[model samples]
Target chain A: MDAIRIDNLTKYYGTARKGIRGIEQVSLTVAQGEFCGFIGPNGAGKSTTIRTLLGLIRPTEGSAQVLGLDIGKDREEILARTGYLPSEAMFYPGMRVRDVLKLSADLRKKDCRREAATLCERLQLDVSRKVEELSFGNRKKAAIICALQHEPELLILDEPTSGLDPLMQRAFFEILRERNKAGVTIFLSSHVLSEVQRNCTRAAVIREGRIVACDSVEALSRTSAKRVVIHGRVDLGLLSGVRDLEETQESCSFLYSGGMKELLAVLAEGEVHDLSVSEPDLEEIFLHFYSRKQ
Target chain B: MTLIKHELRQGRISLVVWTGAIAVLLVICLLVFPEMKGEMKAISHLFGAMGSFAAAFGMDRLNFGTLTGFYAIECGNVIGLGGAFFASLIGISALAKEERDGTAEFLLTHPVSRAHVVTEKLAAVMLQVIVMNLIVLVVSLLSICAIGETVPWKELLLMHSACFLLQIELAAVCFGMSAFLRRGGFGIALGLTTVLYFLNLIANMSEKVKFFKYITPFGYCEGVDVIMNGGLDIRSIATGMLFAVLGIVAAYKMYCGKDIR
Candidate 1:
């Protein structure tokens, strides 16, 4: 069963100069235990979509369902079972980290302080200091703890890894993967590609309030042909025989639309001592999705 | 901590400052004003001066010079008007500051419901207003006792308690307005409080506009009626209670659907 199902969700934000339209006709479904990333640029409706799913803002049109509960009608029940890590957000400057966690625990009707402590230790977050005393990175970690401590069935995180150092970012994704192994579903939103590529099994790309593409990372890359790089003092134009040729002065690479047979003829004649042919990673596919050709 | 405690803590330093000022001012009014009394004509002339201000603050509900009259004017005029302003401003800020500071995102992502967040914050404002009123009452009574003057206990308690309710009822209105206006909570709270103050003015100015008595909690908790003549008007008390209930209901309903941003 799909853990979340969003159907034609649209949100319109009124403003003086061209209002922001978020997630127009955006629809997708994530199966239970799958880790999915919703990747987009800033103001591309990532946060708005997530907020709508959480029932923070009503959709201008359509609906979403989380764990079989309607997004609009069953918000409290849905929220009760879900963990969320909002992007950079505010905490009472006066609230101690422990107190913030305790307050959340009280509201959720659960005591995950021990688990929160464990997560903090694992994330290298200090639970002793007040929220105000923490740096941005530490604050995000604190928010992460509050979201994950509840043992929720689903985790909805908006730019969850933002403000974290590289080490913390990796640790966060590792934690997310481990949680997914425990049968938790994750819907993560981010603009950064590396984090999503490293953690997500699949992702959907949203552009200008509409989903432009959705697929497994591997399939999305495979759909573009293999890219071969001959990084050297080599003339990039020489590799033009290969399909989807793209070059920058000294080096050249191309998306090999055909099989390896086509690459051998082109490469055999060149001083390609160093050559590499690999399936395009998510980053390249994401570029292709957002590239001008689209 | 709930938003209430968080807010109360934020306002504590200001709370102390404001409350202390109120206490000192009331004590001074009690201590110095009595000795400065002159002839009956002079007293009546003085009452006339106080009455204009009283009428502005809706304190002419009784004769201005008697003990009950004095309590209504001093406590009701100063404490009542001032407390309503404090409570409404504090209440509105408490409700909307989370969003303004970008903290609502932080707080709302937790498993907590919005209802808990709002209710807890409002509870804190209630406690603050109570504390402020208590300071005035404590200072007023101590000053009266130290001066060896008698106070009508029943009327005094009724009037002060009514003052407390007036401030709280305004807080409820501010709290409700916060949910709908979000960023505009402060403006709405201030504007409504001002409008209600005038509505009470209009309600008192004539019998024709007395229908406005239903609109202003200040009118319902008329300081003069409670202070001078006797007990509170039950019908007016019911009206204040009704507005309070309505305010809470509106806050909860509007907030449940409000965007946390």
Candidate 2:
């Protein structure tokens, strides 16, 4: 069964912007225990989509179901099993990090002291300090710890790793992979394609309040382009019939969707001046695809 | 209950600060009022001005000329201001604070209904007011004994008891306005307190707008008629209370489905 099902979900603010909204008709579903990344540019309705899933905002149309329960009608029951990290970090200023964690745990009727302590240690956060006194990054760490402490079944994180350093980011990714391996579904949103490419088995690229593309990283890259950067000279005109041909003034790139037979045939006729063909990253393929329509 | 405890934890210092100031002022007034016993006319003028100030602050029902008069005036002014300010702070910020602090998403993400959240927070505001009022009463009793004044205890008790409902009702008004106001919780709560007060003032000054009192918590909370008559006016209290219930219900109704940013 799908852990989360969003069908024709739409949300709008005010009557004026009937034409445009933060999220509109955005629909997608993730199977149980699937690791999915929601890739989008800023203000492309990524956060809005996540908020609707959490039932934090009402959808103007459509609906979402988590664990076979309607999110709008059964918010508390759905939320009971969900752990969410919002785009922004927010907590009561006067509270200690430990207190905040305790409050969150208490609300969900969960005892997360041990898990919270471990998460704080892993995230390099000191829960003893008051939230208001902490630095911006530290505060974000606190929020992350709170979200993960409960060991929830579903994790919906929006821009979850923005404030982390390189070392902590890797640790966080490892934790996510470990959690996913243990049957926890993860819905993460981030601009960093490299992280998504490494961590996510499947991803959906959102643009203009819609899911423009959804597929595995390998399939998306395969469908778009593969690169063969020849440092020296190469014939551009003869590259036709190669199926996926994209050559800039200084370089030539192609998609491997055809197969190695075509590439081998092309290499045979090539002058072979320091030729190297490598798989393209999701970023390169995505950009290559999007830049065309523009 | 836990939510109310949390609010009290946040608002305890403010209540104490206001309550402390009131206690000190009460002690001083008790000391001074007795010294001017022989000079009735001058004392009456001074007390009258004090009475008007109480009215401005929301203690309109009590005259300030006699011991019972001073008691009514002090209770009216001190508790009235405290209640209005308290309600404004708690009512508006109850929901707004979650948004302001960026915790609305986090809190709402839990297995708690918006209705429950609003109800819990309002309960906390009322609890805080009741606790603060109780403290003021205790301190007033001590000061009354210390000042050694022989006064009508029944009238004094009646005048001050009216404040209990007044505080709760005003707080509820601000609570309702918190939802209605587009700006934020605190802005709406404070705005309602100030707006209703002037409305009450205008109504009291003339016969034309006396009916306006029915619409505002200020009219009943600070009305002199309840105090001067030596009994509580169930009509005004009931009206103020009706608005209070309406405010809570309205806040929940709007907030349950409202989108959080």
Per-residue lDDT of candidate 2, residues A92-166 (tens digit): 868998888988898887899999988988888888899899877787888888789999899988998887888
Off by over 4 Å in 2: A16-19, A228-278, B41-63, B180-185
* Model 1 TM: 0.84
Chain A vs native chain A, TM-score per candidate: 0.85, 0.84
Docking class of 2: medium
lDDT of all the models against the reference? 0.77, 0.75
lDDT of 2 by residue, B75-157 (tens): 55566666677756767766766766677877888888888888888888888778877877777777778878775667656
Among the numbered candidates, top lDDT falls to 1
TM-score of chain A for candidate 1?
0.85
Cα error, candidate 1, residue B50 (Å): 8.9
Q: Mark the 10 consecutive residues where model 2 chain B has the least summed lDDT.
A: B54-63
